[model samples]
Target: MLYFVYTADRPGSSALREELVEAHWAYMDGFEFHARGPTLSDDGETATGSLHIVDLPSDGAARAFVTEEPNWRAGVYAAMQIFRFEDLVGRTMWEFPGPEGERFLVTGAAGEPVGDGVIVHGRLRGLDDGAVHGFAACVQAPDADAAARTVRDGRDLTVRPWCFGGRR
Candidate 1:
């Protein structure tokens, strides 16, 4: 299954994150990752989070991937999201083929992460509006619980799961 993992830096953790970028990339390269990248805003220089797509056998494997990741091992993330996506567009953020990145439409209930689903839409890879209280990316996971666990480890999180077109 394809799992989309979204990682958000903890408060005041950007410096630590910058320090681990190279190592993070190098580590991801060693795995069976489709494409792991940072989430850039409209300006495209400010990295808000990270998006990673990986093929795994089960949620346990996905959990292992997160636990063994360089950045996560180095404490670079404050939260993350794993989605059981279907590749509605069947494309990657790098394959969107536009000078401008994607624009996503993430829909969900309030206080539970409304933009998590938007990351799946290629055009809106990391784009968000005011309602998008937070940011997230999408992927296809073995199941909904596994997708949710990709971000939560018995901790509080504002994650939401929705159908394909639901991703704005």
Candidate 2:
């Protein structure tokens, strides 16, 4: 199964995140990742969180990944949301055809299934347990509005400026 691990860093934890980068990378090397990167600020320089799409065995495996991750273990993340994901595009970020100008994480309870321009798309896991809930996506778009338009389903549509994550 594929799991999307969205990790939001604690405020003012950049220094701690930087300090654990090596350990984090080394730990992540053990998994087969679909797409991974840090969610960025509007300026595209400051990282607000980390997004990782990984293929694991079960929901327990997904939880184990987060619990053992260096950054998560070191108290870098203020919150973490894990979801069961589907690869609508069926490709990784490296294979995305869009120009790397600006990107956004547009997610909500999807009413209609997404068709195109979706770099990554999947369903969000329930907070109570591993039950599947609404859908989500990470898209490359010109702006937040455009990104939100890509997934025209569900209430409380949130559009956050994002970028390609992970080391080049």
Candidate 3:
């Protein structure tokens, strides 16, 4: 099963996040990830949240993965969401033919998946109902405005700058 796991950090957990960064990576190293990154503050210095599309064995496993995450365990996360995700882009972020520009995570409303500068795109579905509820995508463009326009046609759309996260 695939899942979209995302989190919003507590108001002032930056230090805790920094302290657990290594542990976070160590834990994530065990997962099969389609995409992973930290959503950031507009200026790009502070991490606001995290986003990852992972392939796991079951819903229970996915939930456990989220709860056991280093950040979650350390109480750095304020809010979190896990969804049954359908990976529309079948490749990892490392293989993305990303355009030259900033990266943004655009989410809200489901529609036809676009290509171009897509790093990873997927359908966000209800965990229990299994019905697609929205769209989540990582895209590269000149700016957030361009990235938002890139994934045209959506409701409640939001664009957040996403800082690359992986063993690079």
Q: Estimated TM-score per prediction?
A: 0.56, 0.88, 0.95
RMSD of 2: 2.1
lDDT of model 3 at position 162: 96
Question: Sorted on TM-score, highest at the top, how do the candidates line up?
Answer: 3, 2, 1
What lDDT score belongs to each candidate, Candidate 1 first? 0.50, 0.79, 0.87
Superposed model 3: Cα runs more than 4 Å off = 113-115
Off by over 4 Å in 1: 32-35, 40-45, 100-168
Name model 2 segments beyond 4 Å from true.
Answer: 111-116, 127-130
Ranking by lDDT: 3, 2, 1
**TM-score: which candidate is best?**
3
Report the C-alpha lDDT of model 2 over 53-131, residue by residue, as the tens digit. 8999988899999999999989999999888886666787777777766777776765433545677777777534757
Higher-TM-score candidate of 2 and 3: 3
- Measured by lDDT, the strongest candidate is 3
Candidate 3 shows a clash count of 0
